[model samples]
Target: MPDVPLTDEPLILDRQPLPDGIGERLAAQLRFIAEADKLKTILRASPLAAADRRENDAEHSWHLALMVILLAEYADEPIDVGHAVRLVVIHDLVEIYAGDSPVFVPGAAADQVEREEAAAERLFGLLPADQAAEIRALWDEFEAGRTPEARFGKAMDRLEPMLLNWLDGGGTWQLPGATESTVRAREAGVVAGSTSLGSFTGQLVDEGLRRGWIRPDEA
Candidate 1:
């Protein structure tokens, strides 16, 4: 978003005066919209229930938004569904740049935190300054997971992939180090936002165990 020539041709300050009202705001917003298209290419570890290929970040974010609409009533505390939807969608825009870190794979990305922070800054900074800060704040709220909306958003975040795994013939459950116990520990946070979702996630793991989809880990 530097002040380079807005035209297709090379820089020419003297070339016919710049348009009377070229809107920087619209330009930045359009750039962000175009950049977000890359999320569709950033594939995740979880498989789609109906497809053979892994789910992409854009698909994952859409599913989370739908979950907020359908499942917000199940939250442990009352939540703002609209706000929660925003959190879940904005939560992964960082991954558009930093890329995804698989939750089931231990040590998948050692510097995931650092990478995501930098991604957040660069991606959101594509917007107008005020809008950039606003969107980034939503991302930070989801990461903090303190507010009611954030907690439920976090719950949906963990639950979606687990649900997909269950529906997709074990999905990521077959990854190295994945086990009933470890999955439970990682996904139990779903309960922190919604006891029902927590219980449902437990049921999925139990089913995985019964069907021999995931191994039993004692450690």
Candidate 2:
């Protein structure tokens, strides 16, 4: 019967009280799952493949998970596709707290690491201790982009938006700070994980430029 004040909190569903005496661990895990659902509300600059509107973090993550499953064979090195799927699924849960930072936006990446680090702690801490540590480690591994799975995960992460942009007629590539030169440079690391995908991305980038959908680098 008390006032539930409105706040700037991300669009999260109201938690339903469990039937009395549910164990704290299960409750905590469920609460963390619900909290992470806020990823659905975090919008990114990349347009949907339909190009009708922008996609949210949840959709983006789902797409990346599928991409990992389909494209793991293209990886430059052996990688556990299941592990890579996990990475893609959880990679943007941090965006629930930190919010989506669009790559094409100049200066938006400032303090991104610091913000995401804080968000990871606060968000994943919602889980029970051991589970929290495990998921947090995957999040960190994806961020570090060191291992084969993580590297391939990172490759899909970068490639998805590039594919989206090309599919959407240069989606965010038309935005400021997204010249062909910069995009190619930014996406060049895809090769570290998948030589095939990196080569394909190069072809797409060049085609976008030729079609005049992407901005050419200023001379």
Candidate 3:
């Protein structure tokens, strides 16, 4: 062969010539981001306000984050909106692996915490050590619902689906086995977050009952 050069051979892949540490960290972060994107595909039992299709975990999280910005003033206690937004955005990320659990589904929530805990570990572990720890901590805080931010985050979470269901004429509430008591019980968390939101949801549930869209609990 005439004047064969190393440049003539193509590399197996187009790899960036980044520093080892930087490259490794960037790869890990990218992998986590890719994995997190799956949340957009995981559907929830609740439908969009007026749309025929059901909502996905990613949309729910985004809605809760936006609601936090607009409704923070209604919280029973003052809240840190930035922190609340972060909590809401990451709150349902575990659902990407554990799957969505309907609030009014009988016996469905019994082992939900356990399943989500395992999912949190696996999913958050995809990030670099520090980032993984930070996200896991935020998730834990939201689950605990003790801090003001966490409480407000939860309020937004409960309020979004409730509004959608109300607007959709008792969307999930009309599903078989769903009843007023079961939904009220599950949504008790709303009052813990914001009394004003709690009142609004209570009114919606009452309206759903009067309209005969929601039946009384069999229990």
Candidate 4:
């Protein structure tokens, strides 16, 4: 047999070296892109507000981050509020591309997965590989609603719109001709995520009726 060289095998590199500050540069690039794409929620047509008065995705993120802080104490299950907050802050980043889907619309959610998945690839891809993967994982977790943090994050997501509708005297609900059953169905998962939040939502619904924000239609 021909003599085989001990070092004949090619050396496989364990990892590729990243360019200096590549992660940070990519993070900065993503930050700027996200800020520029702040059009998502703001583009939503709101009859209650002036034609120009719309909430941007950045504002939505800030609102939910605050909600996570304010409502963490009321969670039915113990959650790392920090993680939940992070999830909320990033959850709708895809809406920067996919646009916000009104929750009351039936079948609208069916297209969300495809739109958001593509958005995720583009948005997250702006970051360096490892950081992109991490953020993408968190985003996916929030979408899946499987983890405790994700459940809490989703609960907050639903709760914010309910509160907004109530405060604005059924703004979107009025436009969408939202019914009690529709509201209930949209929010039932929130209750499943956190019973305390569910109870609070029920109270809000009662308050909405009392305040003339909503009314019961004939059965």
Give the TM-score of each candidate.
Answer: 0.88, 0.92, 0.87, 0.76
lDDT (Cα atoms) of all candidates against the true structure: 0.83, 0.83, 0.81, 0.68
Clashing pairs in 3: none
Per-residue lDDT of candidate 2, residues 1-219 (tens digit): 111111246434344555768798998888888777677778888889874988888899999999999888999889989999999899989877777777778888797898789888888988899999999999999999989999999888889989888888878989988887779875787877888899999999889989998888888
Error of 2 at 22 (Å): 0.8
The positional error of residue 210 in candidate 3, measured at the CA in angstroms, is 0.6
Q: Write the per-residue lDDT of candidate 1 for residues 1-219, one digit (tens) a residue.
A: 111111233212223334556688886776677677667777888999987888888899999999999998899999989999999989988877677888777886788899888888778988999999999999999999979999999898889989998888898999987888778875778988989879888888888999999999866
Model 2 vs. true fold: TM: 0.92
Model 4 quality (TM-score) = 0.76
What's the residue-level lDDT of 55 in candidate 4? 55
lDDT of 4 at 167: 62
| lDDT of candidate model 2 versus the reference | 0.83
Task: Report residue 59 deviation for candidate 2 (angstroms).
Answer: 0.5
Order of candidates by lDDT, top first? 2, 1, 3, 4
TM-score of 3: 0.87
Instruction: Select the stronger candidate by TM-score from 3 and 4.
Output: 3
Residue-level lDDT tens digits of model 4 in 39-59: 443444233233335456666
RMSD of each: 6.4, 4.1, 10.1, 13.1
